[model samples]
Target chain A: MKSAAIAPGDVTRYGLGLAAPLALVFAVFFIAPLAQLFYLSLHNDAVATVWGLGQYVKFLTDPFSLSVLGATLLLGAEVTLLCLVLGYPIAWLHQRAGHWLQTVIILIVLLPLLTSVVVRTFAWIVILGRQGIINSTLQSLGLISTPLRMLYTQGGLVVALAQVQMPLMVLPLITAIGRIDTNLADASASLGAGHWRTFFRVILPLSMPGIIAGCTLTYAAAITAFITQSLVGGGQMLFMPMYLYQQASTLQNWPFAAAISIIFLVAVLAIVALFSTLGRRARINGDAT
Target chain B: MMIDRRRLLTSALTLGAMHAFPGLSYADARPLVFATFTGSWEEAHKAVLVPAFRKASGDAPVVLDPMLSVDQIAKVNAAKSNPPIDVMLHDPGPALVAIGQDLVEPFPVENSAYYKDLIPEAQDPNGPAPFFQVVGLTYNPDTVKTPPTSWADLWNPDYKGRVGITNLNSTLGTGWLVEVARMHGGSEANVDAGFKALEALKPNLAAVAANPGALATLYQQGQIDISPGNFNAIQILKARGVPVEFVAPKEGAIAFKTTIHIVKNSPNKELAFKLIEAALSPEVQTTLTEPPYLIVPTNAKVAMTGEIAKVLAKDTDELKKKFVFQDWKTINQQRASWIEKFNRDIKI
Candidate 1:
């Protein structure tokens, strides 16, 4: 016997029941504040602020904001690329190797993530600082006359971002690649494709979706990250979050901070779109079978 | 029926929001969440300010949010309308900014006579917030054998690479700069020669420390020797047996002052008012000047002897003659440009 179809009125009632509470919570916490943010972004609320596009225009035109947006994109891309380059190797090794080897690899990647961000960043600082382990080692080994300036540099940012986001890249890639049939790779090899050819033509193409997904996640996280960037950059690293924090707090310019946030949101979405487009093209070229 | 539903929801919303807020009278009794820069204020609030506030309000505890000055400014700005910090202990610059932006309300003076207790510099014409000075040089005695007699000696070649200086952005840094300027026959009016002198000492300098305590700790472990830092930091460090020495240099030690202004749109105005009063009360100010950390007292009533320092210049008169303090407001106004130039000019 078939169950009776749900009535339109019942569906409406059910939808309203869920939507109303969600709308209420969002309205109170997220939406209302966001509405205020919109207002702030548009107008000066300082002297009983009236709505104008001055703040938005200011944010759009600001050189510092542009540089921050640029840096954010670059850092995000670097982190994602690093995750792809480094993560795939670890993930592949884990898949091929025995359970004990896989455990060791898993532990190694997860170790930094398991630690607090603050602790991890501090560890990096210690390793990268002038008087830190890296410098001391370099000095003891007679690598150079003076200590190398490694910390508070973009290179440092990439290293840290890569380390932090590597797990993000690895876990997903592993999940996707591990699920791929081992027989397909073997068959491709038997059909005379070299190991390198097999990796590029078969495995790499198959793992594109996972790679894209992982890269997108990493880029978003790395770009928006505040604490790691700030610590590593030494307050001089003028990232978007740092700039946003300063404008809102130091300058007492809420409108400016909101406007900057809007800019950040736009940039992050643009990056995700750019990468996802690449993923879409890859999906199209790869064929349904 | 539609009208009834809308009206019911509207009424419910209004009531719900209102219920979240305190009733008008007891609103003043709500806990005033306050913050001060970490260091001496930590001990002062924990050991003294908290217990007294608890005693006064019975249930309205002052939540202590400790922070660095820069971080404090950032956090307060983040939570302005709905401020997590109801009251903050800010230095002259931020206090000035707070007053300028109307972020803080004026203090309510119950008695005009009691207001006379503030030093000439502490008096502010515009707001209820007054200045607090932690005068005297903060240094580690164990690191320095002679215990630096003058500001000139801080630039000595022996103490190079072990000397800690304040960030050029802060009053403490400018204080060191101004003293060196006067020593090299320059005035606060022209800080060029002084900045040059400071730049000259840069090769020997350690990192520009964020707080006096950091400098003191480095100095305590014999990692650093000179930290021409804060007054209270020296006191707190000495109290903790860090072997830190506080004295006036011959060119006059720079006196750094910070003003405390009540926040304008505070949830606990009455309690905030009371806390300020109690903070400035004799009971509170005295503890800030106890043995080992015997800081100079602003209150005419709080007794501070000249015998506080155990070094080169033992007496207060001799100390005052040597380390003359500059006008803070004058220095604070021009700090942004000066610090920017200093950062560009100095290597460390």
Candidate 2:
């Protein structure tokens, strides 16, 4: 038998062939169910006997639904911003720390991810409860007369979500910041750029890709986090996931639930697309500089 | 008998496929799958009901697939012809939904030994209720001082920022809402009064818990002092030393029938019937009514004992007198709209 020469095109074809099984699985499992969901969303009623865009119309037309959508999107932004603010310092510290300290920082960053999300959220409940640590501490210190209501509040929810999703933010930032050349920052400093100026000009822009990546991961995770959202945010604080659950599971309104899912998917996709566009622009600007 | 590479690989793939998809190997004689509720219900059924079922059926192969009632409905609805679950347990609201959706088979009531034994409220042709989940005012006794005698106690300004509640996503929440509406002169069909009451309750509300489970957490954390709570849930908390006390208000505690139904087109229909029969039986019900479980029995013959007797009722007569059963058929009709309204209006 003659040995056949392998071309780059052949490698690509072989790669496609290897991906065929997974593609088939996705098509059958994920794509098929998603298609069914979309089809279900088109119906007017709960049973899905008649086909119409009534479900979408009902969601989009209703101010309540739109507000829920807005609140959910805003929640993701809040979480992302908090994660960025808190996580950037830790990621920076990780990069600058000694070998042992770097390992310690990484472990600390990753420790929350290791435990279950439910466990972490429950821990947050304990920490933010009426007679919880903060409340007791404040009361003992005579800081306040009444226990500050923290659990189930939006502010408390954001903080808990930020803590839970910190790893998702920090991991990407660490990798992105690590990718930046140390010599670039040193050269900027040598040129009489102050520490703050060096950071603002060199480090921040260079870390934009990481920031974008971290934000995207965190934003998606925080928004779609059903367990954390429900447990932390409470019932009255209706986020998209909880809203969708209330429709689908509680009311058994499949059509409406499907519509909510589709709308949420589209909204999240749009946000992710925006992030990618920003990342691309940042890259272009970085290259231009 | 030569194991060639292609043949070996093909055989290996076949074995792996069979392992991954066990239904391919045993589609005809799959064990009975009863989709009971998660947590305490799962524990009660596993300990008391399953044993009784096994004993009656001569140790028949059974699987306890614990899930929420709505989930069971969804699962069966998705696969009408070949349902994964043989049996399903539901709260009153989802029971109506399951029946309306045509996802469940009518209980063979005539053949059931305990169907006639069940109290009038528990007996349904569609699905016989094996258990009754009682909802009443639960309070932190240490903090509450005076035991609340009525639902109106929740509105008292004395307990400001110390009350908890769940949204309409749960059976407990919806049932409690209907009861609240009834207290405010609104029936099951109309809960506008309930909404008004909830609005009034905003001041006292410490945490509008996402679910009943979260309410328990609030009590444990001292986040809430008083709330409309499930009897069994409060018992579970009390057992764990949570200092929570359940009291049936003067208006009457809401009794939600925890209905059990055989799924449509279940392969193990006979076993499913046997299992449900076991669930409805007095012996199993009595055991479940005892300590740790504290599940209120629907079978009239089962002697009410322990915490259930003390907290809920002494017997079937008292139970009938004390427990207020709502027309869930009426409630289920506009439940979607009510939930939507709740989502819109309720904000702390």
Candidate 3:
């Protein structure tokens, strides 16, 4: 066989061949529909025959639309924060657990995702209802005279959404924490750094990519979660997805729905961007130190 | 340049939607897709209506695709060119929208046999209603000592935390708003009175379930004693061994007409018409109005002997007199806003 050095053009050709399928798939599935949604957003009617930014203008100007957007952001942020605060320790434990124990722990974390969201929401309703298990147990224990109203409350909805989204947060954190070189943590501890100090300085900083991934995924899912929010919040939550459904299906206003969808997409993208920028700045600051 | 881009994107999106719809290009003896309810309604159609339809149409095959009315309408809206749905079974609320959007083909009166026998209210320009879902007070007889007579009784302090109301997305929900509006001295033209009345009932309201299944759960669990629900739903619950009773309130109840419309550009228009005829047939109407489904038949000729006749509205004129029917086209225009206000105000 003749010895041949691969040229730059050959390498470029190989790379393009490797990327072609993915590029085609992305164009077919993602970019095309996204463009279509944007186009649909511009029109003032359902048929898409009418062409203008009237629907977008209306959505932007409507107080109801604005409030729904606010609620969506609030819910997404709250769920993401809750997941981070609760998931970190769980992920840390899973990272440190024995092989069999880690498998069991991972299964527990993923069990909720395996179950139907509707089923889970309904279970929450049963657990949190006035005459539910909690109330019954409390009453039996003589904790209070009156049954506490937990179902249909904002707090109750947060609990349900957080429960469903916890797995998403935990799995990413586990991956990030597992990837962390334990030797660095051991080095920090050997150098007389305490547990909390080593974790804050070494472990958490190393897990930034995972944190960002988990938060982005959880927040995005939480914002768009229609069934859990509607069932748990009892249609009183008025989140963006529910509002979009009302606009699209109930009112038969496809244009308004498209506008709201775009707004939701932009809001989510902005949050993700903000997180990425903050992470980058923090990493730069850490490098300087 | 921008206009061309817009047109191109628009065309691409429109083309994309053609793929979004379920496959309609199929070869069958009776190639038709009928969209209606799931569970018992679907079962009833399969066991009773489908066979009756086959016999009525000389053994033409029919396919029943079960979905909620809202979803069916959405499917139609998404695929305007050729919706996979050939026959749509929906409430008058969505039917009106379908008509306004020109998504439905007008009933072929020349093709229908029992179209004239249908009640005048059912004989809509959009489509004839095969059955009626009368919105009345449903209560567990075991829980409540007093039998509530009027819609205003929902506001009574004794029934506090016992009454159930549907959220604004449902037909019963909007109907409740309209009914309350009229009760509180507001007409269809202005439902400001409706919102106020609804807000007033907030304290008494035990649950604001979005669908029949949820409402039924509330009743089954004894979380609710009374609520405004449909006649069919109440009967279905009763059949399931729930101790429930239906009453057409003294102030009158809301009657939602469940219409069957033929989709425009459906390949099975002839078969669809034949199926509609079978649905409106006396035997089929009786089957629909009987035990499991318990829907009120719209066929004027369908003689109800044992149980259904006692529950059904007296006549089409009586239905008009007793229940408030709003122009759904007008109602739809404000539906999104009304739902928003409803969600905001009616905090259960």
Candidate 4:
């Protein structure tokens, strides 16, 4: 009935007009690059060979491939865990703080996120270096006479990644936490549930969606991250992307690199899909949207 | 609010960095890009090594993109026509691969006085390429409690978490493998025992460093105890006030050579050779051994060097007895197999 007053074709035209820009962008950046990569992976040197998936097979079977994949997954999981552990408190703090304090806390939370990955990674290098502030301070405090080895370890990589990815976790959880009414906490307190108990029983059940979203986002990012991992992990990290980088550049095996990348993508997608299924089930059980 | 510019400096220095890194440099300024891949090696070249080449030749410089030695040739090969490259400096490993692909034309300016009397390995046996570069260890005298004369000193307990290494896939890894094999236990030919020897020194590892600026900074700060740094890199390190010592191992590092060649499509073809000819000249090569760019010159007669420049003299007469030179012929023939084996063996 209302369709008589409205122009019928306008909806499709407007929807298409809005989507046109994004489609063009997708075609240009995503589709074009993928096609070029596929083309490259098929060729031996400059000339095209039969478009076979030989490159993928080479990368998959190589023993080094497993090490890199394991490393990437380890780093990704470490980053995600750190984000959830650290980011939750900061998100809660922001949600509960007074208006100006919350604004300031939010701004502080966003600062690392705003800075480029390279800048943050460089900062880590400077701070974690043997003569860097941490070592310098510890030495001055008479904590240790020598600078502890900190810069190029797995711990150093964790700190750098966690710092860079914290905001990704915090922002979403804050939004979810903010939506929870104080009435629920008040009600829980009246029923004799303590702060920690209420936090576990009341607040957490409500924030699961944000937690899931944040984990997914940060996990995905950490998996593909090359620049930060390279800088912060300091060649100690045997990451899959780094292996892919070596294959394309040093080994000159584009096909092999492509194959490894395909395997990685498949593995990552499978893991993410599996995680999301578990998250969806949890959401259903918790009665949270 | 009194904003202090000097306070900014104080804060930055306190924070352990002042300005952004001096933008990482490359060799040529022209369209001809040469990725050096060995990060510290590139930093040394751009900062200390290539400057002399530029000054002596007066040719427009090309960007010297530093890379991991293991991967530079692959990336270059990947970008053959739309090559982000025109010239590159590589050791025998990739040079073998490059030759297999016909990536180079015959290097024209090779009949130099120094090249004529090269220590066998410099001349490319399978092809017409000029031998140009060498690799070895550089140490800071202040950092090392006991200075090393051979590869065995690297496995010292004191150096646990002290030493740095370059890209594991490069000649640095291969050279270290070969040297340790010869000195420690294994034969000069097959390095099974050599690879195992390096395993003992694993704990003392600082970082498998690839970035030249990072290595230079570390060396300057005395963070590195014993690390793989090249001759030109050490020269650059010393100039930066890092108290460095050059260690031409009793068994000299298998003197890996980087052949300079002209590209088929290099626009500055005449300019390129003139620059090459100029670079190969005794005077230019002599000049290279001094001041900013402290390379061991390709010229035998030109013995000029800076006060800090360590002349890498081979016990030329005792090559068979002392050194384990890489047979270019053998390496060239088994090139692909060597690379595959290096991968399967090191599994990096």
Candidate 5:
């Protein structure tokens, strides 16, 4: 008993000592800069001579700014939802496929991750442009006379973002679904339950943790993806990342940009928190059953 | 000397620290760092200006740090006491901002050999412009047939859903807006008429590109047949066999002075001045104005020739008559709000 108690304490202390170097690095690089950013955001003016909460007030009070925030959040939710819907079936297929087929599926999912996001975004632009593959094909088939505009539209942005962030959703789900006992599904079906019922009761509830993790990853990435967002969405679509860039880089309004960043960070954190809370409740319900 | 573990670790850490904080090793007297614009400008300077500067300064060590104007400002502002950049190149809008922020030293005009040789517009005591970036209409010659002669041609009913533009984030976009406002009886102080003109341009609009660079890609993709484009950028695209043509609008092409300055408190002030001087020299300017580069020269002494003379001007007098220089001082003041308004209103 004495050894067991001492071992736990000793291991924790050793673990902390091992992590000390990284902690110091984090404090020096990340925390210090973040603190400075927070300090800078407190200023009222562009040059940051006057100190106040004016920057925050400017963002919060302005309806246009709030709409940009809302649109960005909505964009994340749309991309995440699309990813989950598309990824779930692939994860399920991955779970059921033969070994060779499983390798092929995994390759397809992981292929996009190998190439840079820029290459992928540019590929999307080519795919969606006027006189592009889709338009030419459609025109040849007599499906449409004029080419449809798709490149810079909201729909195109969502589709492009969904494809870009799909790996984040799929990878977590593959691991989560793979963790399930195969016999449980058989048992679920044998108990007078249909395939849909078994999936709902046996598979999805068990994969709650993965869903939450994937949603969190995809949501954060889809919103903060500056390059993909700007390239795919064009100049008119004002997202949080581009808004922040315009202020900080173009206007030289660092204080306002800092304030925008802080607000965006909090907003994203709150959504992640909500996802985890939902996961916790689902876990509790599963335990009760 | 026997190498021990502790001694080896100590020396490794010291080396690493020195690498991380370069100030520890070279406290002063680093090479002259010139922050030139990226892409073709970097290539042009690396080829022509650097060689000229080296020859003038008796082969002094110089480094070309290529970046955007705003990035250069941010970096110099961060280290005002010991600025990393000895020299900076800027567009008209950012030149005013850098000057306002007190980040640049006034040009020593009296000492310069070629300051007076520059056109009157390029001569600013804050920092003289060595080059001019002309903005005009770029179009697909194969599709448009007759070349676009005026900015008004962008809104032609026949070219519906074929015209593209960029938002007011870039110097190109903002300057174009001011010119449009001027066309519609508004000035730098008010752009309401410009906004009204844009509203009427909605039917013809195909894309509102993020920047001037993206506008080129749109042309390549055939997404837009015509748009307001930078002269040099269009040349690069045309060289790549993109079937594009640049024509100065009847209203006169917008001429943005690309200014060079010595960063305040730069360690290599003399070398910085030498680099700017080399940039201002007619020999270097004429070389940069040639094929592939196609940079418009600001020096009155550099005789125009090749593609620049054919398309832009044959001499300084014609160039002045054809080029429209907007008051960037007035434009910079209202730029932020205009960008905001664009963000709010410009949705097709």
Candidate 6:
């Protein structure tokens, strides 16, 4: 079964057969539309659009657009950080728990994903509204005379987004943690490292790939999310995707929308690239140790 | 002659790709794609109008794609060569944008019999106006002891922390802004007065709902007691037992005209025109003006009576005297900048 034993023609046939379907899909679905999107981004107008970079220039120089970009990045980063903090423990428990418990926990984590984003957001509104359960309970307890504003705030937005994106973070981290040999943690303990020390020194560094994967997925989802942000944020908290939708659809400024979309895509990619580089460094350092 | 296997495979794949687009295979009898609102609106059409159109047109296949008007405009513009939407039902704001971008074609009003039957205002230069909506003061009678009589009454201190307003994306929002501007001695040309008025009202505002559905939800939850909304939404809520009232503010109401435009370069142009004609027919108009849809008809032939008549303007003169239709083209142009300022300027 050695590769060197196989004929060159057979190897070529096997490779092509294995890759043909995916390569075809990428060509038709991903690469083709992406190329069209880039082309549209460079255009000057909607109908009979001519090739130019005026739309890109306008987006880069506009203060409002710059602020939107900042908000999108900030939301994405906060949500990703929150997801990691909340997801790590659940993922750890998922890995160490009994088989039946693991199944139950995994199902619980995946429950939100089963429901529509719109439904989940509406549920959050019922929980977080002015006269909602939380405020009513607080009022009865004489905690405060007035209802505290929770819904439509940035904090509310982040909380809802983090909850929706939690499962994405946890699943990947679970896979990464599962791949780590339990012996390493045991060995670290036997070698006189405390639980926290062993986790930081061994488990954390080895799970860098999972951390990068989970963070990137969650960050991308939160950043591009429109419905949750629109419904929960009440259109007051502006995000890049919302602005892009307005430009593309409401205003019918296709060139400008295309330009914003391109920039947003690049920004997400840049963040992912940075994490991937860090992941590579962590892997190299772990291997050396 | 050796058969190059790679070359043969490539050719086969390309042919397969070409075959994927079966929609283009038929030159005639393809289902005409018609785009409009979702939920009850779509249901109303399906229950009455679609079947009537089908019977009249010898059972032509029609595909209904339910989408927001903004989305329909975007989809058409994106696919300029062969747009998915053959015809669209949209408000004047989006219709004006569609006309400006050349996404839609001008209606042939001179030749159509239905054109003569429409109220003069409904005969838009861009397209046929199938319906009209009154965007006015909407409130819950159960919550507000004194029903609002004027737009200025929303600024009352008693209504503080209990008011909602539609976001700038909707015609209802823009219509309210125009009225606010006019009331404050500034026209749509100068909306600064409106912004100032809106800023003052922000303390009272509980939510600024982005879409009609969200606004209705806010009303249902009792989060807001007062809002500037349209007759159709109020009718829907009232029918659903929300105990809401649609008041034509004493100052006057702003009319939002709804039009059905045939998309430019549509593959099914002939069928699209028939669908528009069918939608404007007296039978269809009657169905739309009743019960759940509760839309006001632009067809002069379709008479309104009972509660619907009392709320809706009876004639073109009454419409002109009582309701104001803004310069929608100018409004569409200024919408993006206005939205940016509104979002930044107001607290809610």
Per-prediction tally of clashes: 7, 0, 0, 21, 0, 1
TM-score of each: 0.74, 0.93, 0.87, 0.75, 0.94, 0.89
Each model's DockQ score: 0.09, 0.70, 0.32, 0.16, 0.63, 0.38
Best of the candidates, lDDT: 5
True contacts kept of each: 0.00, 0.96, 0.33, 0.25, 0.73, 0.43
Which parts of model 5 have CA positions greater than 4 angstroms off?
A1-15, B1-28
lDDT of 4 by residue, B59-146 (tens): 5565666665445555555666644555655566666667667666566535443445444544543322233344556677876856
For model 4 chain B, the run of ten residues with the poorest summed lDDT? B20-29
User: What's model 4's lDDT at B329?
Assistant: 43
**Which residue runs of candidate 6 sit more than 4 Å off their true CA positions?**
A1-16, A45-50, A287-289, B1-27, B74-85, B264-271, B313-320
Cα deviation in Å at residue B33, candidate 1? 4.6
On residues B31-85, what C-alpha lDDT tens digit does candidate 1 reach at each position? 6777765655676667776777677677576787887555665566667776667
Best of the two (4, 5) by TM-score: 5
Error of 1 at B63 (Å): 4.5
lDDT of 6 by residue, B61-173 (tens): 98889898878977886799989889888888878777877888877677565777888878875678887877888898988989899999889999888788877766778
- Scanning candidate 2 chain B in windows of ten residues, the lowest lDDT window is B22-31
lDDT of 5 by residue, A161-197 (tens): 9999999999999999998989999998888889999
Model 3 Cα lDDT, one tens digit per residue, B171-266: 878877887888889766669998888778878877777665677667776667898887777777787788898888887777778889989887
Give the TM-score between model 1's chain B and the true chain B: 0.79
Q: Is the docking of candidate 1 incorrect, acceptable, medium or high quality?
A: incorrect
- Best of the candidates, DockQ: 2
Sort candidate 2 into its docking category.
Answer: medium
> What C-alpha lDDT does candidate 5 achieve relative to the native structure?
0.92
- lDDT of every model, 2 decimals: 0.67, 0.91, 0.80, 0.65, 0.92, 0.83
RMSD of 2: 6.1
Question: What TM-score is obtained for chain B in each of the predicted models?
Answer: 0.79, 0.91, 0.86, 0.65, 0.92, 0.88
